[model samples]
Target: MSLRVLALLVLLSIQNLFAQQLSPEASIRVLTIGPGYNLNDAFGHSAFHIQDHSQNIDMVFNYGVYDFDTPNFYTKFAQGKLHYLIGVNYFDDFMLMYKRQNRTVQSQELDLDTGQKQALFDYLLENYKPENRRYLYDFFYNNCATKIRDVLQTAVGEPIVFHEPEAFQPQTFRTLIQDNLKTNSWGSMGIDLALGSVIDQTATAEEHMFLPEYIHTFFSSATLGNSNKKLVKQDKTLYTKQAINSNKSSFFTSPIFVLGVIGLFIVIITYFDFIKGKRSRWLDFTISVLTGVIGLLLLLLWFATDHTATAQNYNLLWAFPLNIILGIQLLKKQPKPWVIKFLKFLFIMLALMAFHWSVGIQVFAPVLIPLLLALVIRYMYLVYYLKNEKL
Candidate 1:
């Protein structure tokens, strides 16, 4: 064997030896970091903390780590093909970073025996190795918080009975997400637009751990398989967040106000066309083309992207793709019979959207209320205009 290969083997052996020798004073903890000001940090973070006073070892194992230097980073991320890796850093450094951000930091020390603690620590080290670290990230099924929950359960080699928190109730994935965001914020509107009806289904109780705060709550009450003993031994708050000024927002820039204005403008134009006994071809073409484009994009997201939550989108009911084909019919002075039928279909689709919302099949963004009303009124006028014209 080459000298370099032999040295590498020796170094790995030494590292394994150290991992197996975790002292009785060592503790394995779950660290939950509170939310921050950005969309990415809105859900917060979860990590494993390993501390051994006797051996002078204190480090955090984080599964949410991703490198921006990765090739084709933006493209891969958009396609949901980005790989996230487990990273290790000193505990003090991790704490300091969150402190600087003014985010609350909390810790829950697991009630693991010395053998279990050593086993978990060793397992984490093995997972941290280059070959095993990187994993495909799934937003709902496999993420930072879920990883911590799964790893801790695996380390215990027991069925963890995660009891539902007292305040827990069933909620859809979109509702859970919107709960963390401002109702009228750009982020919320973007999420509603980009994601489809798949996220409208109710999330199961155990599935709620996808969020860091829920992980903390569930783990606090979880127990070992069929045992009365609780999983967490102690809970500690490492840092309290300081209040920051929150009066930095305005209503005019919000989606509700912006879409509302557009809706009002559409209504005014339609009323003018009614009085003149004429249809605005430009406005009709624009709305048709816009909805057609949005429909095409939603279809692409549903079929092409790896995003699991974008399937079965009902938004296409209102943003019909057939509008592209029907839009050309609007330019002609004499409308085709098929065009009138298509207008009726568009009005029906709008009604179906309202029905869907009413029956809780899917909940759309509230910002769309005014826009939907305008669409219905415009379609009704178009149908009347075409039918009343001389054949």
Candidate 2:
């Protein structure tokens, strides 16, 4: 065990001995930390803050902590089997960490009575135990933000009736995520590619708590089941993010710009190949390997992984895994007769992909437009060349 774990155990024992009952001045609040620049921190964070002057306890219970040293960490993360822990930090230390990150921090005091406050605090303490701290983390349902809402409901032993905030607007899960990411960013494109149509469905108001800001907004207007009293008794902004201009990347480095350039080059190469009545075997091989590898990875994400959001992905239609075989055939002096039929099938798949995009069956990355168009043209040219080739 690490020193941190030992320290937490010692702290827990001391708290149990002397702070069984919190003083009337003890307060329990929810802290909402604003989003940071990185993809991992883009969704912001939520934690529970418990403070008591009489007991000399001031701690933040955060559910977002994960160990990078865990065995097979990256593999487990990719398979959606990674565990997150309930981390206990000194309240001042927690604030200082976020302050250094230049993220905004807001707190909302709960309107719970002394008994309720103690119950919630006790529950957090019990949950903080080593065995109880680790949990299977889910992005939309059981992440740090959603844990705050669920834990509050569990501790209060009552339903939380969350009302829509005044500025609330209906949005899908994907859109909620996109709100925190730049449209042309690699992070946004990756999310659009990996997650499927499930996130495209409109999220219910209660479901919006998956995001930290939404947790604050909904909790501000929420009430306990037994009473109409507001769940949040007070609110305060502990830190405001500074207005320093971020170093934005140039458009030249953007996914759309880079992909567009590659796509244009492919189209130009295909045009030359068509005029010369010749096929660029190397180009076909490269494109096929790239799309085939991507397709296989997507297929694995859908079936081999525990990720719920990667299911029913339609990107496979454009990135056919069988293209790898076609690429091999294209290298032969006399390709198989079925290669022509396979190219036609790939063309049809592209058309179906376009249909799916048009009807909102799935939302693919917008940056793929140029690449997809180039692919269609290349496939069509290949079909023509194969059909006209002599035995």
Candidate 3:
């Protein structure tokens, strides 16, 4: 062979050898971040940490990143069609952001062999490349937590046997979510109202890994494929929250208290009208319009969105879209003949909602109890008034 060919072969061999060499000081860890004070961060977050002392590299690979500048950002996000990308950030920068938020951060060092560690690191580097990074985000099936689980299993080229956490009990997705939410908070109520029957079904043990906390818990005892060897070599807290009273929220401002006050107002107006044998068109109109608009939103979530949890919602029974038409009719001194029939239909729909609640078909927001009761009374009176009022 020519000297040029020999030199080229030598350079190729050198590159290959360098690529295969992962420094003994290199470490691979999974970082689990605790919840923040926002709906989006309520469930927590997960990311991979890669540090090599010899290479002067310490970076975090985050799968939960999305570009806000993407075309039709809000629309695509609402429809669940937005792309989430893997992002590389310096370890200090990443930890600083979380610390500033006062969120707890925990790190788990993985028990990966040198070859496995390099394979995983190389895979993450490739995934961080612009064209290779973006992936379709799914709440339950795929997300940051599941990404870590999948990457570790793939890197090790072995099945990871995730032992169930000691505190884990079988639970529905909604219940699992509720564990993080304050019972009477708007976030909890909004989730219950927006989501549907599908979330009520019991989630399997493996399915619970969709949440970051569960991912951390299960991986604590996870073993390498058919071996007694553990997946995590060591676990330690990267950051712990300092006691800060300023970050606290008050229960008086919560959804339950606010909704209860509104329910009381509705009941007073409704009761006074029933006793006086006179209907308050404005109050009735407000109820219909409010429920109707919410119903329309729920309909869009169920049909137009790619969110699986929003399907087959039973909240529609109470917040019917027809309430808008009925509300418009309530504006007339003498409504059309169909008005009474529609009122009756609404009352029956409320009954069906009660059945669903009792049978555990769909669990609604507990904060809605007073409002629901008031609606039932108002709806009943509307049916009676429309039938008995002089035409």
Residue 226 lDDT, candidate 2, scale 0-100:
62
Report the C-alpha lDDT of model 2 over 1-391, residue by residue, as the tens digit.
5767866765765466334789899999999999998999999999999898898778889897987878999999999999999888778878988999999999999999888898898889888776788999899999999999999999987788998888778998889999999989999999998888888889999999999999999999999886898999999999999998889999999999999999999999999998999999889889987898888888899999999999988889988777788778887767889988888898899899888889888878899999999999999998888778853
RMSD over all Cα atoms, model 2: 2.2
Q: Write candidate 3's Cα lDDT for 25-82 as tens digits.
A: 7899999999988989999999999888787667788797877878999999889888
Q: Indicate the residue-level lDDT of 207 in model 1.
A: 89
Candidate 1 Cα errors over 4 Å, as ranges: 1-20, 331-335
Candidate achieving higher lDDT, 1 or 2: 2
In candidate 2, stretches whose alpha carbon ends up further than 4 angstroms from where it belongs are: 1-19
C-alpha displacement of 11 in model 3, angstroms? 26
- Highest lDDT against the true fold, candidate: 2
Task: State TM-scores per candidate.
Answer: 0.91, 0.95, 0.91
The lDDT for every candidate, in the order shown, is: 0.86, 0.89, 0.86
